[model samples]
Target: ALQHYHKPSIFNSDQGAQFTANAFTGTLKQAEVKISMDGRGRCYDNIFIERLWRSIKYELIYLKAFDDGNHLSQEVSTWFRWYNRQRPHQSLNNRTPDEIYYESCL
Candidate 1:
């Protein structure tokens, strides 16, 4: 989806090991996508993703303790659904990410 809907021009991510790995970079390059990486140790350069991680951990991960990978996956999926639908975000003008994104498209 995102290509079918938003069709973003660029994709950006932090210079983490995962993003730097050949597997990840190769896939993006194959898609003819331009990749932008944050400078090392520059937290502010990736503030949006950092804030998203903080919300995910604090609102979901920190509150739950799972027994196994399956359990964690289920709970995380549920939490992500709720986060995108129900949770209001300050940066989004009190709207959930889904709401803001779809509304902008309209």
Candidate 2:
């Protein structure tokens, strides 16, 4: 994910082989991003993102049938744009994620 987007201050993921692979970790280290791994038996460490995934699957993926990868990618990107810029999150006090993020920068 970081390979294509803005560098994050910290990257958190489960201790899956892909995440722990040298190539991935080396890229993060070179970028000076902190690495965080979810501990064993602590499932809720990534609950928020997991919840977002659930929302995406149920609300978008499950509801659409794409003809190709490009189609799926475009639709997913559109969904994410709406999710960040329009959809209000209850946990964020009914504000969109984009709103909260830009507000924090100020």
Candidate 3:
């Protein structure tokens, strides 16, 4: 992710073992990224991501039958591209996420 996209100022995640692991946190620290972990039992802290997952599941996953992990990953990647670059969100005033994100970057 650091190679393909600009490094984020902050990385947020649940208190999962994979995220808390030294190797993972160390990499983020090396990149000068701040880490934010949600409080235990505080699912609302990540509501936006949770909504995204719900959208992915309803719009893509539930509709498709994947042959394997590779296929699933590929399709999901395509869906994400569409989601970010093409799909407009009412919450974002009908602008695609890419539009809002790049606009904010400027």
Give TM-scores for every candidate, taking all chains together and pairing residue i with residue i: 0.85, 0.88, 0.93
Q: Quantify all predictions' global Cα lDDT against the true fold.
A: 0.85, 0.92, 0.95
Query: Where in model 3 is the C-alpha error above 4 Å?
Result: none
lDDT of 2 by residue, 1-106 (tens): 7678778999999888999999999999999999999996676998987899999999899999999999999999999999999999999999999998898889
Clashes of each: 0, 0, 0
Over 1-106, each residue of candidate 1 has an lDDT whose tens digit, in order, gives 4456554567788888998999888877777778998899898999988988998899889998899999999998998899899998887789898988788888
* Among all candidates shown, the one with the greatest TM-score: 3
**Cand. 2 TM to true fold:** 0.88
lDDT of 3 by residue, 12-44 (tens): 998889999999999999999999999987889
Ranking by TM-score: 3, 2, 1
Clashing pairs in 3: none
Which residue ranges in model 1 land beyond 4 Å of their true spot?
1-7
Show the lowest summed lDDT stretch of 10 residues, model 2: 40-49
Cα lDDT of model 1 overall?
0.85
**Cα RMSD (angstroms) for every candidate in the order listed:** 2.2, 2.0, 1.1
